[model samples]
Target: MTARALRRRAPEPTGSGRGWKEQTRRVSELCLLGIVATVLCLPVLTVGAVVATLSTVVAHWIDHDDLPPLRDMGAEFVRRLAPGAVASAAGGLATLVVVRQVQWLASGAVPGGSPVLVALLAAAAVLLTVVLLAVPRLAGGGTWRTAVTGGWHALLGRPAAGGAALGVTLVAGLLAVLLPGTVLLLPALLVLALHAVHRALVPGAP
Candidate 1:
C-alpha cells in the first residue's frame, strides 16, 4: 500500500464528537438553570415567576443557541411576579383540593370509589398537560390571562401534542419521585421539554 493511498483511506472526522460536546454543554447549562430556579422557587409564591423566567430562558436558548444573561432573567421574573403569584396560589389551591379528594376517595369514604378516583386522576392529568403546554407560551410576551387562554387553545388545537406534553410531564414527575435530587432540576427539565414538544409539534415555533 502506497503512503498516498493509506492517507486517503483514513476516515474523515465526523461531527459526532462536536455533537456530543454540544449536548454536554447544553445539559450542564440546563442543570445550572434548574438549580437557580429551585432556589428562586424556595419562597413558594415565586414558583410561578421562576417557571416563567425559566421558560423565557429556555426559549431564548432555543432561538439563539445561548443562554441569556442572569440580569435579563431576573428582570423577567420581576415583571412576571404579580400575576405569577396569583396563578401560583390558584394552582396550589386547586392541587390541594384535588389531592384531598383523592385521599378521601382512596380511604373508601366515597361511595363511587374507583370511578371517582379515575375521573379525578384523569382531570388532574389533563390540567397538568395543559399547564405544561402553556409554560412555553409564557415567553410570548402577553398578559397571564392571554397566555393561559392561548395554552388551552393550543391544547385543543393539537390533542396529540398535548398528549406528548403530558407524557413528558409524567416521566419527569416519575423521575423526580424516584430520584429526589432531580427535583432541583425539574423546572429546567420541564421548560426544556415544553420547548422541545412545542417546537416539534408546532410548525414555525421559535
Candidate 2:
C-alpha cells in the first residue's frame, strides 16, 4: 500500500475470536506505547514531539481505529526532532521567566495588583492554551507556525473544548502528584483525553 493509504488504514479489531481478547490487546498496545513515550521523553527536549506524536496516534485510533506501528512513532520522533527541540527550549524559557516573575512578586519587588503582573499572567494563560492545542495540530503535520496559528484559532473558536483540554492536563498533573504510582498510567490517559477533546471540537472527526 502507498504511504498515504497505510496512514489512512484502520486497525483490525484484534483477533477474530472473543471481544475480551481485543480489549486486552488494545490495552497492552497502549501500555507499550506509553512506556516507549515515557522513555523517549527522558531527555526533556523531545517532550513536545513525543506528546504530539502520541496525540496523533491516539487521535487516529479514536477517530478511525487506525494504530500505526510503534516504529512509526519512533520515526516521527526523529523526523520532528528539530522543531520539537525548539518548542521544548521555548517552553523551558517561558517557564523560567514565569518562575522569575513569581519570585519577584513574592519578594515584593512587584506589586500584587500591578498591570504588568496581570499581563504576564494573561500571556502565560494564552501560551498554555495555544501549546495544548498545538500538539494535535502538529501531529496532523504542517509547519510549526501553521500549527501554532491553528491552535490559537481553535482555542478562540471553541473555548469549551479548550477548557476541557486544560482540565485534562490539570487532572493528570494532580494524579501524578497525589498518586505517584499512577504516573505510569498517565501517558495513555492524557493522550486519550486529548483525543476526545479534539474529536469533540473538530468537525467530521470520525
Candidate 3:
C-alpha cells in the first residue's frame, strides 16, 4: 500500500471521546493563524481574500446545484460581522491573557526571548484552537469535541497531506510578513477557500 494510503487508514478515534476537543482546539488555532495572516498581509492578500470569499459561494453551489447563481455569500458575511465581532473580541482578549501567563512561566528557561512575541504567537495558536472548536459548535453541526477529533484524524491519517497543508499555511504566513504589499495574501486566502471548497465538494473529505 502507498504511504499516503496507509496514513489515511490510521485508527483515529471518532467523535465518541474527549480527543475531539483537542482536535477542535487545533482547528481553531489554524483558523486564527489564517486570520492573522490576512490582516497582516492586507494589501497583498486581496486576491486571496477574494478567492476565499468566493469559495463559500462555491461550496454552497456545489451542495445545491439548483441554487441561484451569484448568491450573495458576501452579504451574509457582512451580516454576521456584528455577532462575530463580539465573539472575536472576547476570544482575542482571553487568548492574550492566557498566552501572557504561559510566556511568563516560560521566561525562566528562555533567558533573552521576548515574552511579548511569544505570548502573541501563543495567543494566535489558542485563538485558532478556540475558533475551530467554537465555530463548529455554534453552527450546530458538531461539538467542538467532535470537530477536533475528526479534524485530527483527517490530518493524522494523511501525514503527507497534512504536512503539505502546514507548509501552505506557513508559506502564506511568511508572505504576509515578508511581502506585505504583494498579492500572496489573496492566493493564501484562495488556498484556504479552495480547501473549504474541496472538502465540501468531496463526498467525505473528513
lDDT of each: 0.84, 0.76, 0.46
What's the true lDDT of residue 135 in model 1? 85
Give per-residue CA lDDT, model 3, range 33-142, as digits (tens): 34544563344324223333333433443344322233464564444444445544554577677766667656654354566557667656544533332222222223
> Least accurate stretch of 10 residues (summed lDDT) in model 2?
10-19
lDDT at 91, model 2? 83
Cα lDDT of model 2 by residue, 54-131, tens digit:
877876666555577768866877788888788788888999999899778767787874667778887888788777
Task: Find the 10 residues in a row with the least total lDDT in model 1.
Answer: 12-21
- Cα error, residue 55 of model 3, in Å, equals 5.0
**lDDT (C-alpha) at residue 85 in model 2:** 85
Per-candidate TM equals 0.86, 0.80, 0.42
Each prediction's total of clashing residue pairs, residues at least 3 apart in sequence or on different chains, is: 0, 0, 15
> Residue by residue across 1-206, what tens digits does model 1's lDDT show?
99999999988754344567777887889888999999988888988888888888888887777789878887898998998899889889999999999999999986779998999999988787778778888885656677677677778888888998888887888999999999887778788988899878855566
Predictions: Cα RMSD each: 4.0, 8.1, 14.7
